[model samples]
Target: MKDRLLERLPGTRTATDEVRGAAAPVGLVPRVSGFYQEWITEMKKVTWPGRKDTLSSTAVVIVVVLIIVAFLGLVDFALGRITQSILSF
Candidate 1:
């Protein structure tokens, strides 16, 4: 995998070579820039969610969280009441 990735970068050495006492990192700048270049290329291919889809997904998440919070609040109140009743004896 490292070799294949290095092949894509055209001119940089694998970081393994640097660890193995290869000379100065002569290709650091090119390597970093190439990584970002690949990032932009891949990002351009993404199917980003539209505004409506994003809003609907966020609403679902909020509703689920609220339901869970309410459920947990009831459970906590029940436990507190049980504990108080036991201690008051």
Candidate 2:
């Protein structure tokens, strides 16, 4: 399985060596370009979320944040009232 996976990888050591032997030594520009090309290739394989999934995830985050904020605000208010009563007495 790992051998098959390695074979699927872009520019594995043996492939890189063959290409390097045929061409000029890889310079910084080629290296950077190769990195970006590989990155784009890998990105293409990614399973990105659909628009509906993204929207639902965002909505869930917003709802949770609002709930936490409300709870904190209520706690602060209660603490403030208790402090005031204690100080007055």
Candidate 3:
């Protein structure tokens, strides 16, 4: 038993040293400084819309939303009238 424990001492010391070396923390200053550079690089890759394309896309969205709102309003008005007629009878 004594020889077995003695033999394991070197392995345990090597494992502990490796863990201590590998577990060291990283610094934050370099990451913070590179953020603006990273952001500008990403923005350059985007395909931004022109004035005519932007206006047409915006108009389409507004028209579709208004049509949906009008349809819902008509449905609600019809349902209310039907309910009122049934109750008045």
Candidate 4:
């Protein structure tokens, strides 16, 4: 898998040479750590929504879901009544 990955990277490693000699991990650990730090810094810069915004969004979602559930329940009840009436007839 390592050999295949190294082969895929352009201008990095070729297939002929010994895999250990071919694969030289230079500054990989520091680069990954820097990436994490940069990601955290970017996240801190984001304009996060306030508590009011969060509450309103949550309320809207709950109301919409409740309306849909009520609608489905009414449809199910009507269908059940019609089915029972037809079966009885």
Backbone clash count, each prediction separately: 0, 0, 0, 0
Inter-residue clash pairs, candidate 3: none
Please report the TM-score between candidate 3 and the true structure: 0.57
Q: What digit string (tens of lDDT, one per residue) describes model 2 on residues 1-89?
A: 99878877787665556766756437999888888998999999999999999999999999999999999999999999999999998
Segments of candidate 2 deviating more than 4 angstroms: 1-31
What is the Cα root-mean-square deviation between model 2 and the actual structure?
8.9
Give the whole-model CA lDDT for all candidates, comma-separated: 0.89, 0.89, 0.84, 0.87
Q: Rank the candidates by TM-score, best first.
A: 1, 3, 2, 4
Q: What RMSD, rounded to one decimal, does every model reach? A: 9.0, 8.9, 10.0, 8.1
Query: Which pairs in model 4 have colliding backbones?
Result: none
What is the clash count of model 4?
Answer: 0
User: How would you encode candidate 1's per-residue C-alpha lDDT over 1-89 as one tens digit per residue?
Assistant: 97687667956767676799835435989778878998999999999999999999999999999999999999999999999999999
TM-score of each candidate?
0.65, 0.56, 0.57, 0.52
lDDT of 4 by residue, 3-83 (tens): 778788878756454555744446989779878998999999999999999999999999999999999999999999999
After superposition of all CA atoms, the RMSD between model 3 and the true structure is 10.0
- Native-vs-model 2 lDDT? 0.89
